[model samples]
Target: MQELQQHLEATEQRLDAFLVKLTQRAQELLNGFEQEAVNIRRNDTIYGQAYSRFLAATRGQVQKLREKVKEVEETQIMPVFYRHCTQSSLAGFSSMVYEWRNRCQAKILQWEEQLYASESAAIERAEWQDYETVFQSHLQQYHAEKEKVYCKQCGAKLAINQVYYYTVYITCTFCQTQNIFNPGTSARQLEDTARKLAEQRSRPVLEQQQFYQQRERDLYMQAHELQLSLIHEKNNQIIKEKQQAIARLEEQRQEAVVKAPQLMEEYHRSVFDELNNLLPDLREHHEKFYRAITTHYQ
Candidate 1:
């Protein structure tokens, strides 16, 4: 396993290095093309008139190199992806093919556009027409103008040279199963397949998210229940404390009521003793009158 991992890592590094090299090469090719176009506009040299040819050649070489890189990566990746990885890697294969297909299509379009932009010049009208005719011929020759396809399963080659049913299907002539080389497919079929694949890629992630969400909800519910139980216990403790306080206050009130009659009788006796002391002081101030009044009252 370690060795395989190391090999894969090394391969990835090499692939990355190659991609950098390819990018640099592509930039250089584009710069060369722009320079050639400038030279053509300036009428720099006899060869400058043929600058479009050089540009086309450079683009074609770049495209071939790109295809070579794709082939290398696919050859390395496909077998491992199928044998070692899970179902998810199937989408990776589709992506790899899509990239390669788009790269090829872009290159073809670039060359076609370049050819359309550049035209050969001549001195006279007839000469110009002849030049145009020859230029178109060469353009067709250099481009080959045929979309070539091959069967992935059986290695059968198909070329689009003319308007025919062959150009539409371009399938494997040997096996009519549409298993490998169906370059031309119906628009509806393509759309449906793309939609289905998009759904498939999302389905796994969606299910995983739902599972996590359900787990979170269950944990929250359990925590909430525990919180509610703790709160109920605290409330019960508060109720018990209130009951104890009320009971103590009631007992104190009962003791106060029991002592009330004795306290009132003592207060009345103290008041009578105070009045008797005051009467002796009054008799000392007025003795004769006090004696007369006392005898009369008696």
Candidate 2:
């Protein structure tokens, strides 16, 4: 029993040392990626390509770290405990493993948020701004050119009072002729641009929604961990306590789940509010799209 305790202690120390090394390696990778990202010009054509490569590399490195942790746990850490301890005695070691793995995974998630999320958002915003410039230029030209359209049959000048995304029939006041008016491709494409711009503006609300989503995930993980503990707990009292804890965690998870829809509703309302403001003429279309999205979520 003493030898087994010594083995368990040694194994834990080894895991701790291994985790530190892995963390160091992960930090180095993040530092290198950040340096590379800082050097890449946002306006460069290859900027997106470089970012994609960096993301893939970072994910690969994280995967390797995960595999290393699993390898060490299986080959060095758990085997000794499993061989020397009964099922109930193994529970503590399993919890330790769980904690170490969680820490490693959490570190990876932290690195991803620190190194990627903001940079990705910035890149998206920059790209959107570039598109917005072109879209505004074309919209201006379209509006200026479409102010007056002459009837083909009677050569009477007809006034275009509103922007049309698609083809329309304008009845000439002079000859009562139906003149076909096409807004052209650029004007039609404005619908897509308008939606994109609105979404870009509402990104902050979307991020808030994502935060609630992550909270739900974390609660679920906590509940699952407690369930595992319950499975391994031999003492009736401890098992009952774990079950109660799991119940509380499950309640919290349900509450978190409820918040997701509420937050999503907020995001949807915000997006369409911006959409309606940007293209008041297309409110009907926006409302239809919003209804479809909200219905799907429900």
Clashing residue pairs in candidate 1 (N, C-alpha, C atoms within 3 angstroms): none
Q: Residue 259 of model 1: what lDDT? A: 41
Measured over all alpha carbons after superposition, the RMSD of each candidate to the real structure, in angstroms, is: 49.8, 6.1
> After superposing candidate 1, which stretches have Cα over 4 Å from the reference?
1-3, 44-51, 86-298
User: What are the per-residue Cα lDDT tens digits for candidate 1 across 1-298?
Assistant: 4554455556556656766676566556565565556545456477344655665675577667657665765675455544544445454344333333334333433433333223211111111123334333443442342344565567666544332212244556676535332323332232223333333334444444444443443444343334333433557776576556545554554554444433433333333333223223322333454356445644
- Which residue pairs collide, candidate 2? none
- The candidate that wins on TM-score is 2
> What is the per-residue lDDT of model 2 for residues 155-270, given as tens digits with 9 covering 90 to 100?
98877776678888999888999999988876766777777777777888888888888788777777776775564468998888888888998898888788888888998898
- Score each candidate by Cα lDDT: 0.44, 0.70
Segments in model 2 whose C-alpha atoms lie over 4 Å from true places = 1-139, 154-156, 235-237
Weakest 10 consecutive residues of candidate 1 by summed lDDT = 119-128
Candidate 1 TM-score to native: 0.27
Distance (Å) between predicted and true CA of 29, model 1?
2.2
| Model 2 poorest 10 in a row by lDDT | 119-128
